[model samples]
Target: MTTHPTGTREDWLKARLDLLKAEKELTRRSDEMAQRRQALPWVKVDKAYRFETEDGPATLADLFRGRSQLLVYHYMFGPDYTAGCATCSTIADGFNGFAVHLAHHGVMLSAVSRAPLAKIQAYKKRMGWTFPWASSSGGDFNFDFNVSFTEAQQRDGGIEYNYQREPAWTAQGIGDTMTKRGEGPVAENADMTGTDVATYTRERPGMSAFVREDGVVYHTYSAFARGLDGLWGMYQWLDRAPLGRNESGTWWRRHDEYERQA
Candidate 1:
């Protein structure tokens, strides 16, 4: 028979201890970032932003629906677009649980996109998500938050009426504004600026938050594709074999080999 190491038990225990330490470090970092996010500058919502609530036809202020704090996730779902972002849908799938917990914290959270009410509702059903997903059919909110693109700008690549360009982490609510929300001459949108608080939405990250004295709610974030790896825990599907694969720790699977079939 082959002989084993004299102190393999100690080695395994040491490895486990190291894993615990790393997990604690990650928790500490998250706490630190949360505090920093709270301290970040916040822009003011000057004009009354509009949204289609579950009750139908509501103003931006109405998004809170009575709560003081609000969190608006600018999911990508424009009228011209075919499907809502798959990655964002995954995040929403997980968000269903958080939606209830957030209310207990006195913080309200909802998702908005530029798609029509009917389309958005249909997509929500297809994904089986019960979270507060709403439509932003009439407003510059999507473009302002960098989720939706302009006609001319979308056609930059020569594809007419397409929203293709996906830029890396653009600044929050910084872009060209259409005439009265796509009616007049284009100019740099400076309406959602002013507070020391600046917010942004782009790739390579997963979600953002804003806090305030009266309560913080802002239109400035989107979680996409790999942008949501760090913020996980909902999917029991991830309990299979190792998620991080190869030399890159970024790859992961949602299910085990045997359970993948059913």
Candidate 2:
């Protein structure tokens, strides 16, 4: 027998109707937020950022592939990471499906990582993703966007992420634990990426938007942390399920990690 609460049909209907009103209110608020996002002013980008794509070198504008708008997912695959971050990999698993559709609709979707081109290509192939991915290795693109931090920045805790300054992990008492898992988010994902906590943390996950108009590219918007919840395909589905996310810590891994499911 299930442990969930049971009730009469009329009782269930009453509860569901109440939830439906709240759901509609949430939907309206979400629509308002979308309008606000669209109304935000676009800041012109002057930096000459370059990236290494599968097809030779390309500029940030080139990633749009003739589209007027571009979306870049800041994947957390640092230069020294042996593998991609598990959480990022899971988030990206849904991209290949919608990327083609987005391109057709005048928007381009791609991923940018601090890893080398070869590493990014290998991981993309392993994950069977056909979307365009670029490498920002040896470039200041990630750091300038506040998605990456230097050792000095991490040590001093003077970096801004998710629109606020966060204390350095070291200052927060996050020790380097290469072999330990389940200690915390930093340690767990660090182990999954086959790197130390600090190295894995140097790169953070985010998404940035750009718009090209009349030979100029403008930075339109960016979102970090839970701001990206809408873009995460899995969570959208889970939110509608009876039990919701039902998460207790990180209970997910790279799609390929569960070989038995394959």
Candidate 3:
């Protein structure tokens, strides 16, 4: 009565064993890639970037919090948005648990966004998240990192993200183009954030790594798009599920929004 392949226990074990070999090889490759990432050269940060934290104004170095390393999640919360990106929010949910562990291990983790400090605080409280969140409002940090873009940049195709040039977002089709018949992930995400596709897309989600050496901050690494797959905790578990990701369009929501959907 099932559509899936039927197999005896012996058959299942044989297939699973074959998969185990591939999985192990993937794990080994992942370890090698991590080493390569650590080997990448770091670029010195000379600009004096500032942020607004709950504790008041702070510099990029202060984000390390006495630690030598800092990991910033470039959260997609533009100033105009009423809420955070659902996908980014989901990724951040995992941060609250591991941030303390990172802090103990000489690494401080925080999330930076273009939204104002007050808006960030209200949303942080609503989500019950205690992890450090900072506001880079009126700051060029996001733009310098290629995670935030202006309307002119969007129209001129001046946006370069994920290490490549992105196509210009035309003003005429801004809203219509992003929403594919008012469906799919982008449109759904835009609706969730209470913004049109143009505004929602002005901000991007990514993570950046930095290290403070001898009182100077250096950029170590950055990842975007699919490069961030490893940090999405739920996806790791889903990969081991019977149906794997089993995705179609936008099938996820902010953890709290699920209750309302039901």
* Residue 25 displacement (Å), model 3: 0.7
Quote the lDDT for 73 in model 1. 70
User: What stretches of model 2 exceed 4 Å from their correct place?
Assistant: 171-182, 260-262
Lowest summed lDDT window (length 10), candidate 1: 191-200
lDDT of 3 by residue, 71-184 (tens): 999999999999999999999999999999999999999999999999999999999999999999999999999899999988888888899887677644333545565457
TM-score for all models, in order of appearance = 0.64, 0.93, 0.96
RMSD of 3: 1.9
Cα deviation in Å at residue 159, candidate 1?
16
How well is each residue in 1-262 modelled by candidate 1, as lDDT tens digits?
A: 5474445888889987999898899889989976876666667666666778668888766766576677777675556545554435545666788888897887777888777888888777766778786787878766555555554443233221112343222222222231233222111111111111112111111243433446545533344434455545534345433553222321222222125534
**What tens-digit string does per-residue lDDT give for candidate 2 at 80-128?**
9999999999899999999999999999999999999999999999999
Show the colliding residue pairs in model 1: 41-196, 41-197, 41-198, 42-197, 172-199, 172-200, 179-183, 179-184, 237-254
Question: In model 1, which regions exceed 4 Å deviation?
Answer: 1-7, 154-227, 232-241, 245-262
Clashing pairs in 2: none
TM-score of 3: 0.96
